[model samples]
Target: MKTALALLVGSVMLAGAADAQEKTIRVSYETPPAHIKSRTIEFFKEELEKTSDGYFKVELYPSAQLLGPSEEVAATARGQIEMSAPYFSYIAPVEPLMNIYQAPLVFDSYEQLWKFLETDEAKALAARLESRNLMPTGYWFENPTRLWGKEPLRTLADVQGKKIRTVPSEILQKAVEAMGAQPTAIPGTELYLALQQGVADGAFTAPNYGLTMKYYEVTEAVTKLDLFLGGYLVLFNKRWYDALPEDRQQQLMDAVAASRAFNEENVQKDLAKVDDDLRAVGQQVIELTPEALAEFRDALAPLYGTLDPQIQAMIEQVRGL
Candidate 1:
């Protein structure tokens, strides 16, 4: 009995020591648990914990449970949390180059966007984030931007005289103008109320937000414009990430790479599912006729010409890929 008791105490002490050596990483984001991005993050947690062989543990604080969406980037940079996932636009103020995503209709597909990300310019853009103590681990795609409104906007002319809520993107503002809609820059926090109060007749956003934010309850129509792809990046606190040993760093990045592939495979299908789910709950999803689509496309054709020649060349290069 004495030998058995000693063995038990020794085992407990060993277990405690192992637990003390484990590193805990907390990742926070605002997406609902059912969202694919959220699922990808959960998968990330699973993969990291599995790959680390008891050396690491990841906890997910989703739907702003641990931190609000607006606080995510700053909190991560401050190392208050080891990581956070927020949209590119949310990070753009601190690192303006990320606003390359702010452009409209520049990327026609996820494949093209991935190609653009591999470019030297995109690499440099990511490198710039390190200056602010942020390191992007992986990026998850949002649905393409859509025009959701209280009224059905089936054609370019139909949107005329309507005020559309949009992000503070110069290119997006020009696109809205080209569509004959007055662009209104509404803070995202107040957007639902703005639509409900008739401050804006429509909004430019991903359909996923309509599902998660319950915007379908306030807005009656969604025109699938497919204007541009939007996505969020998972960021690690640079100090925390940089402090990891080489093999540990590679393991974390490998988990991120797997999570990214999972997200890429499922994101588009999940986007369409969100649209369908929205329709089931009484949101009017308007898929414009071919003629109407052509008209809308043509209306914005000149907007592309407004780009600087260098940017135009790059845009062409991205599209050609």
Candidate 2:
């Protein structure tokens, strides 16, 4: 009996030591816990821990607790953080090819966006990110974003000179400006106050953001522009990822892939639910007439001509897809 007791204690000690040896990956993103991306990251954490048998653990810092939107890319590249899930456009400053996600009036459907992600142009963009010490795990596509504003945005003429909040992407800025709206680059955290105080007239974002941020209370109408596909790239520090054991690396990728699929499968439903929530609160949801949408599309066409040759080629590749 004493020998059996001694053996049991030894096994318990061994298990404790193994648990202590587990490696941890710290992930940061700029969305709230309620956001679809954040919810998907939660699934990744669960699947990773389960699939790895607790050999790896994930520490998540959502709502920019560990790093703000603008800081995530640089922080991850420098290995200050192990991972980040930021809007693909935010990474464009470092790898200009990533700006393709922000090009207006492209990607009519979620499936179309996924198809482009598998194309050669997408592969080239991934290579560019790797060159910057960032390795992409996967991409989580959000529902096509809509334009929410204080006033209805039905036709190109309605947007003229309206100061609309947008991300810090040259491509997007140019696209909005070409549509006759003055693009204002403001941080997401500041969007509510910006709109309420008249600092900006509106924004282009997903319905999830509208429901999460309660933008419906401030904005009068949301035109289902469905102008662009917005999404997040789950990126890891290349140096850190390269150092991981082969099995651990595969586990990470598998987790990301599973989470990406889960998010994609649920995003359409979530978008619909968010729209329902917005309407329940009395916000007007506008669906532009085909002619009105065409007018806006035509006004923004020159943006394609203004892109760099490489970027323009990539855009064409995606458009063709």
TM-score of each: 0.83, 0.91
Write candidate 1's Cα lDDT for 197-256 as tens digits. 999999998787667778887888899888788788778899888877889888989998
lDDT of 2 at 136: 88
**Candidate 1 stretches greater than 4 Å from native:** 1-22, 168-170, 186-190, 272-275, 298-313
RMSD of 2: 5.0
* Model 1 Cα RMSD, 1 decimal: 5.6
Report the CA-based lDDT of candidate 1 relative to the real structure. Answer: 0.81
lDDT of 2 by residue, 5-62 (tens): 9999999999787545447788888889888888999999999999999888889999
Deviation (Å) of 302 in candidate 1:
5.0
